[model samples]
Target: MSLRDAWDRFTASQAELEADDEQLEARRRGTQPVGRCHARSRATVSGVIRAVTFAPAAAGPALVAELYDGSGSLDLVWLGRLEIPGIEPGRRLVAEGMITSADFGRTHATMFNPEYRLLAPDSAEATP
Candidate 1:
């Protein structure tokens, strides 16, 4: 699905799902699921990589990417080591994931468990 379509679905479905303070807090702190987020969606966003952070744990590593589209921005977090080639600040990317509110506070939306595809400067289609 197109990015616009996905955003619409997200907004429309958001009101149907509810989460208490504890759940939101855990998701915000990266300790739990943000809410009752759906795993499948056709929506996606193409944006520039504004920031990247790596959170290492005993089990594995988690990568968080801050992406900004023209309308807004969202945090994309991957739970495992992701081989994202050509990933850097200023690089464009198309990501697929579920939108969830920040667990710490109602600051902004985040894309959890993202499976991203990098789009090259000259490539027509996105690549993993």
Candidate 2:
């Protein structure tokens, strides 16, 4: 890539990190950290959406999403859900649910059908 392209990418990443930090702090103001989550205990986190995936299961479709804050990342599984409006990469969200280990040894904190709130896009987070 050209110098201009590389510069743009670098700046973008830094901006993203700052926004992620702010969102995480705001969301976790009175909640547990993702890295410190305890099994079977209720937990909450705020972060930027890293991914959204779709897969099929016996019951039906499943939506698996990952979010990353400054401290850590977590996986959110919505069984029988295909798509949730506003759940996409870079979007900030606050999620609450019981912390549980992955039955299949998968890594990271996880929650099933946790209550979530999509954060409104503010000027700072919306900027490139």
Candidate 3:
């Protein structure tokens, strides 16, 4: 399948998994790895990219992007070789991973081990 098709399928499957309480609990219990969450949870996010900052000097090419998903907002950071393409304000994305709280004295949480797939209105596949 094409990348776009694969991404779409992945998102759909992920959404279903997230809705499963048993699955969510299993994942939370660490019986299943976070990477298995899939792309649908990320795709289901109703948010827009509020910021994008690069930190290439650190461990990897990291980008701190703020996303407000109506219900709440969270800082999404991509580390290592994960490349966030065309990130900007008003751009919406679907991100899936493990949500962990941060101890920075702020009510902040992180979606670790995330797998994101950008949704474009025109539906063009992201070139690798």
Q: Give the top-scoring candidate (lDDT).
A: 2
Quick one: best TM-score, which candidate? 2
Residue 81 of model 2 has an lDDT of: 88
Which is superior by lDDT, 2 or 3? 2
Ranking by TM-score: 2, 1, 3
- TM-score (C-alpha) between model 1 and the true structure: 0.55
lDDT of 3: 0.52
User: lDDT of all the models against the reference?
Assistant: 0.58, 0.75, 0.52
Q: lDDT tens digits, residues 1-128, model 2?
A: 89996776577777576755655575545656677777788887777788999968767888988977666678888988889888898887788998887663447668889898777776323223
Residue clash pairs of candidate 2: none
Q: What lDDT score goes with residue 78 in model 1?
A: 74
Which lDDT tens digits does candidate 1 get at residues 1-128? 89996676577643232223223323333322322333343345566678887867676787777776534566777778554556677776676666775563325677767777777665435554
Candidate 3: the clashing residue pairs are 42-94, 42-95
**TM-score per candidate, chains pooled:** 0.55, 0.72, 0.50
* Reference-based lDDT, residue 119, model 2: 74
